[model samples]
Target: MTLETEFERVSMPLENPFTISRGTQTDAENVIVRVTDEGGMTGVGGAAPSPHYGETAETVEAVLPDLLTAVEEIGDPHALHAIEAELSTVVTDNPAARCAVSIAVHDLAAKRLGVPLHRLWGLDPSAAPATSFTVGLDETERVREKAADAVEAGYSILKLKLGTDRDRELVEAVREAAPDARLRVDANEAWTAREAVRKSEWLAELDVEFVEQPVPAEDPEGLRFAYERSALPIAADESCVTLSDIPAIADRCDIANLKLMKTGGLLEARRMIAAARAHGLEVMCGCMIESNASIAAAAQLAPLLDYADLDGSLLLADDPYDGIPMLDGEIQLGAQAQAGTGARPKSVE
Candidate 1:
């Protein structure tokens, strides 16, 4: 039976401009993939490309036609291992594309088994932790307003983007607005090791939960130095990409935030979570600015994580899919993910 595959490029406007140390995005360009088996069971997934990770929507689109053709030729959505290996050989370094294909296959497999992905993985959605909503880098007043708004909107955990010259001011502003909100920070590899140490100490004073990727990924020595000197726990984002990169930086950070786009798929992501924990690092499941398709895919792995920052869809002004519903930052799986990753087209009746 020949598998049928469909791909499309989508642009979703962000509710607000999201700024990080590396850059800013006012919109998200995603590639949505759907795989329909001979049984007419369709599983959907998406690729949210990150320029920081060397993938753009254009890059993802460029490689997907041939890649999807190869996947269709394989004709076995359930054999994800072979599919992933074949995909890597055809499309190199396009994790977003790989992630899209991988997730579509996983979704199909789960739907075929007539079980939710979490249950298929032998996990419980009820055990999943609440996800954190993010406050992007902005002026102090805007940061305060966003923080307060997020907190008031029922978000108990807030992750703030830092690493600017006014990092302290921004954190202070947010603290003033959402003092009781559990605050975490991501520097996006902008500061020097010494500077990271200083900022981490300052952030500790305000009760920050942890600092993510304070120093550059290229500088492992700097990461270790900052990790050793900082009073707060450190998490590695860019520094940790695929499974092989984990061991090299295992001891340098307290946590590893795994993004499906970075890992290339749910299989690799699950492996990454296990690998991070094996190295004694707490695991965080994260997402880029994506639709509910990929967020729903990542949410299926929520029961295995220590923290979750899967609110990328929440930041969007409009979403084209609905996989997992986030109610006030809480992951409301309910029965939505009962088939595949539980993400379905918003137009479905």
Candidate 2:
């Protein structure tokens, strides 16, 4: 059936500074897409650009108008393969923007089909677990306080933002604050090969479950080297963007951090996971700071993953739509049964 398209930019304030190698952000601006087929079924999607991945809100916003224009021209949500193929030509290389539209289309199609997104992708929705909450970059005391707050809020798993002058100290402090919580750290490609090795040693002492993107994305050799030396499992974030990037990362790292924006959409992300498993790499689905719409899309892929960082919705002060309900770190899929992308478009008129 033919579908209509609408687009907008939504800004959500972060609870604290989200810092990584690229810069710091106090607010998250996401590109939002809505698709409504002639059948009256609708779906919503959101795209958030990560500066660490070399994208900004400005770039994401700049690509949306053209993306909406292209999708409206195609006018068919069910013709996903055809529409996606056409999108590549018009949208080009902006995966974040493409992801927004892809998710919205998927939602619309799924809603029309009357099935949850996981079932559409051949997954059992009942098996999906809760996601992890991220502890943003901050001072040691403040980071510890945030960790405590997350724990108090019923978060079972906590991912800490690390990779600075005081990486070790921060981890130790966070661990001390939330001793029972499962802890993991992400450097966001800030460290050197040598520093990764050194930090991995200290990190091992904190009993961290894994360390993500400890070194720069380009240094596969460094990742391999660190993997060989560290007791902690290494998760490749920036290092593994596409399916082709998986084989090398699987050989070098233990886990893969799959972000929808990085792979473009669920289609590519599914392929990337298959490739990662063939090479014995564990999968962890993650997302940039986004609203419930984007987080809901990523949650559909959560059951297939060993780890989940779908905490983007938790970071927002307000989420306009109740797209996905997260309870005590666990994603409550039962809250929305008909998933076909799980996000419903906001009212444009």
Indicate which candidate wins on TM-score: 1
Q: Which regions of candidate 2 are displaced past 4 Å?
A: 344-349
TM-score of 1: 0.97
**Residue 109 lDDT in model 2?**
77
Best by lDDT: 1
C-alpha lDDT (0 to 100) for residue 142 of candidate 2:
91
Note the residue pairs that clash in candidate 1.
323-343
Query: lDDT tens string, model 1, 250-334?
Result: 8899999889999998888988988888899999988899998899999999989999999999999989887787888878766
User: Candidate 1, which segments miss by more than 4 Å at Cα?
Assistant: none
Give per-residue CA lDDT, model 2, range 1-349, as digits (tens).
4667777888888877787656788888887888887867777888888765667778877877787777778787777787677767787778888888888988887887788888777877667777888987888899999999999999979999887788888998899899999998998888887888888887888888899988887888988888888778999988888788987777789998889988877677888989888999899988888887788888888778888898887787766655666889877676665557665544554
* TM-score of candidate 2 on Cα atoms, chains taken together: 0.93
Deviation of model 2 at 238, angstroms = 0.5
